[model samples]
Target: MMRDQAESLRNMVKKNRSVDFQVISITSGKGGVGKTSFTVNLAYILQKMGKNVLILDADLALANVDIVLNEKPKYNLLHLLTGEKNINEIIWSSKYGIKFIPAASGFEELANLPKEQQMFILNSLQDIYYSFDIMLIDTSAGISESVINFCLAADKTVVVTTPDPTAVADSYAICRIISNYNTGNMELGLVVNMTDNEKEAERIYNATNNVIRKFSGKTIKYYGCIRKDEKLSKSIRERFVLTSRYPNSKYSQDLEIVAKAILEGNLPEKKENFWRRILNNWINLKFD
Candidate 1:
């Protein structure tokens, strides 16, 4: 029976290849760097451009994508893991035309789910893998087991960092960790958040990229930056995404440019499905 089920999943993934879905993991080395906010706004912009988007809140222990959008989710990843609900049941659609899978905040079990449970979640995702043009995973800050696993599974990993020394150092740490496991296939990019101007953004990117190149010999692409804006903080307090609440704001414009850069990447051909690759990575994951 297990063999049959596995074969069925493989066939389903092979047959459903009409749409190409790009899986981008947006992560920060340290917490409170606006990774989640950037993810929500990027999803909104992508959806506005007529591409179906899904935001998977992979933070597990501190999911807040729902809070940013002001939507209450009836189910989360815990429900799927416990067999209380299917993956579809946990997905909530927003008015902005993007769908999201909310995570269980402060749940230790989910934070350290075993390999079998992780495979189950990936299997569930296989059912709806072809339903969107892009799936952005907003991972938790720092280098945890979950963070590394998700970053390895993604087609591209976008490291979000601020101009702070600690944030920049941690961001490079993340790149180094990822480079060790990336095998030269995963595309790595950087986004400088809360910058004063373009020069500051470029300086931060250059400094971080230099360290990464020196240590790992891998290149990190510049995905643009988010300028420091008071309206961004106000939008957060109001529980609304910046793109929707203040479209004409400077922060929103910066996000739009960043989103354009993100979309510029060539979408991987659908010869091999993303879910299959994620499942393979999860199965082969080794913890220290």
Candidate 2:
């Protein structure tokens, strides 16, 4: 009887442990660089690692994260911000363990709201503070004020770019804007996507780092690279995450690495929970 009682107490203790939510924002140097794809896949990978995650399609205009997952968002963040509904009324579940807070379509005026309206929106985000293990924000493509605000508000930012010169330049420009104006302590992560090989991706990352150091005086750390794999496009067309639908694909492996790195954070002393430790072990096992 005493042994059973102890086991019950242990189970209760485990159940009492609260969830920790971290906000991660993914942006790009420009549009058509696959930021939403990265965001969705990364969040899916994190969910696979036994963590509860949230994907906020903060891409006010042309939001496609929902469409990619074949979901129709009934309500979005804007609706909650405008007092039309609460967060619980809008967030949708995914096939993966992650939840989604999609943006309301055709809400152009919400993006250009006055300072009062913007503050209301920012305040509303606080409602889901404890509801997720991580909040992944996939912002719009441009470096507009709204995007800047979302980047600054996020706990961390992951900048997506490709080997193309124009994409590199535009990514660096966004990094400069955040460094100069971000109020939150948002550490930047760089992901070089759609590359043929690691060597080329590394070259692009190194060159961009140099440019940022020289011109912006801010250092952008490397997260990981997503290889150019035909399976990535096919998986998107199928409306499933590469990790889920094409687990053996190179793109999925690369995204898993990047997701692990982001969850680990920058400082060595930054502690991770059981899910993160499981993720680290899983990645190491994959490469082995």
Clashing pairs for model 2 are none
Off by over 4 Å in 1: 1-19
Worst 10 residues of 1 by lDDT: 279-288
lDDT string, candidate 1, 15-105, tens digits? 6655467889999999889999999999988887888888999878678999888888899999998899999899998776669999987
TM-score of each: 0.92, 0.81
lDDT of 2 by residue, 80-154 (tens): 766788877888887665688887667677566654554445445555646667778898887876676667656
Candidate 1 local lDDT, residue 139 = 90
Lowest lDDT 10-residue stretch of candidate 2? 273-282
Give the best candidate by TM-score. Answer: 1
* Winning model by lDDT: 1
